[model samples]
Target: MTELVATTPGLLPLPDWAKGELSDLKGHQKSDLIDGTEGEAVTEAYDRVRAEELDWQTEAGLDRVVGGQARWDDNIAHPLSMADAVDTRGIVRYYDNNNFYREPVVVGELTATGDVAAELDATAEALDDGAGDLQAVLPGPYSLADLATDEQYGDEAAFLDAVADFLVDEVEQFPDVATLFLLEPSLVENPPEAGIDERAGAAIDRVATATEADVVCHTYWGAVPEKPYAHLMDADLDAVGFDFVSDHEANLYNITEYGTTDDIALGLVDGQNTRVEGVETVRERVEWVGEQIPAQSFDTTYLTANTELFYLPVNRAREKLAVLARAAAGEEEVTA
Candidate 1:
């Protein structure tokens, strides 16, 4: 059987303590909390949060673990907002969830203000060998463009290109990253207007080529429009991920037309759903995807949750994560 690595697209839900710590830091700076820790630090917030998450992921038998995205303030766009060219606006609802993020606005030419990888770099150093390789996540250029308002760039095409260029540099700063998950929920959630598919494809390719690590473009939320779906294969991605829970049939059906020589990461676990799925049920879905798209068509695979685990309660999210590991490993006789 093929070994499918189990991982997430990062942006993990804050553990109980981390949530409170973040609350205190809210409308404040992370720098203020550092000195105020005095030595105790209540686990120093994110440092502790990421450490705990790493410990849990290692214990759960995952093959790859994200750095917990502890430093991210708003759905992967937080770090980008810190740049001088981008303006941070009022809180806005992210997708269909109650969670909110400060909107990123393009006010001028986007530039990298600080090292985005610093926290993850420290987290990686703190992890034991048992913790799997650290995979970094970023909001896809097209999606980031859609999520943010463009005040400088007049046209959508230019804005998309600029965001992609900025992300190419941002992702390159991720030190020792093994895999990069370019999260693009907007592509499937709110498809772009017609005729921009080519630019979208280029946007994806730009960020992908910035680093040597295998880049995977993961789309979620619903069936992506056929226009953009058809264009994905032409992009320079090492793998393409599909949200099996949202509309697996359409995702599978569409991929066959613009098939790839790359690997296909299938998001089998439902991140938004509260109900836990058994290992066997998830395994069956994984098998179904394989039959739909022959194993020979792709080089390797990844089995992951359909979206960020933030939608579910922390405990429930972690439980589902373990199940993903079990299903990917083809384990049987799992217990609740």
Candidate 2:
């Protein structure tokens, strides 16, 4: 029996009211700082925002909704930057996106930053009291190394090894998490300098082996480059997510040439674009993907947006999730 699950890569926009609420909460945090309080306001705001996003995901009928990444301060690396060994720098442009994050500078020996797990647990606890399965998103080691400045570790492989080990340790802490998505956009955007793809695969293997949840290595924005694509299939992951919305052909070809038959997370919806895709259009694309792959390659399929839906307005993002849910459930297709 094939199980169809609909979920996102885990960043959803806040509703209009919550957006206003978040601004007010930020102001409150500033006032608390001036008053010399402990700054619980920010934590409170994150919890509230997370619950709201969970409600939206449930309302949209997402079978396996993520925590929605409400704790992401700027880019996906925000929580990682707050680790004990990391020195946070000023705002830096993330990729070519308008989003900005304080650069995570590795100042000492790499270790688990308790912030990521704590936030995940909080969000998971919140979702436990709600309607959807709990999920956590972790930044991939390759992407983390790419986004950071390694002030301590001189050798690139050594640094990447440290990053992967730390992530493996982090994932081990989430025993109850239903799913874990490792965002590895860097592999597609900037392939490793050289001789690093093997390390990348090892790192993924460490985490995937250590975790109890369904682990997925989700690469987006483009096709996985030939370098990393060469060895990524051997990693112990439950599913490899491909961003069909961006470059479906190359992704499918990579699967046929370099990958084995495995469960797959099909990324058919466009998260960065404003235009909402119709239910029928997305289903057609999913079918097209099936024709491109070996007939028995997938037993379980995750219907998802290509990346975070934070780029869209809250209402539009919710609509997209709803359409994905509709398609995955084999309901009548609505007019992309």
For lDDT, the strongest prediction is 2
Mind giving the per-residue lDDT tens digits that candidate 1 earns over 139-176?
A: 89888888899999899899888888888878767788
Candidate 1 regions exceeding 4 Å error are 27-43
In the order shown, the candidates' Cα RMSDs to the true structure are 2.9, 2.6
What's the residue-level lDDT of 37 in candidate 2?
33
lDDT of 2: 0.80
When summed lDDT is taken over every stretch of 10 residues in candidate 1, the lowest stretch is 33-42
- Report, for every candidate in turn, its global Cα lDDT versus the true structure: 0.79, 0.80
**How do all models score by TM-score?**
0.92, 0.92
Enumerate residue pairs that collide in model 1.
none
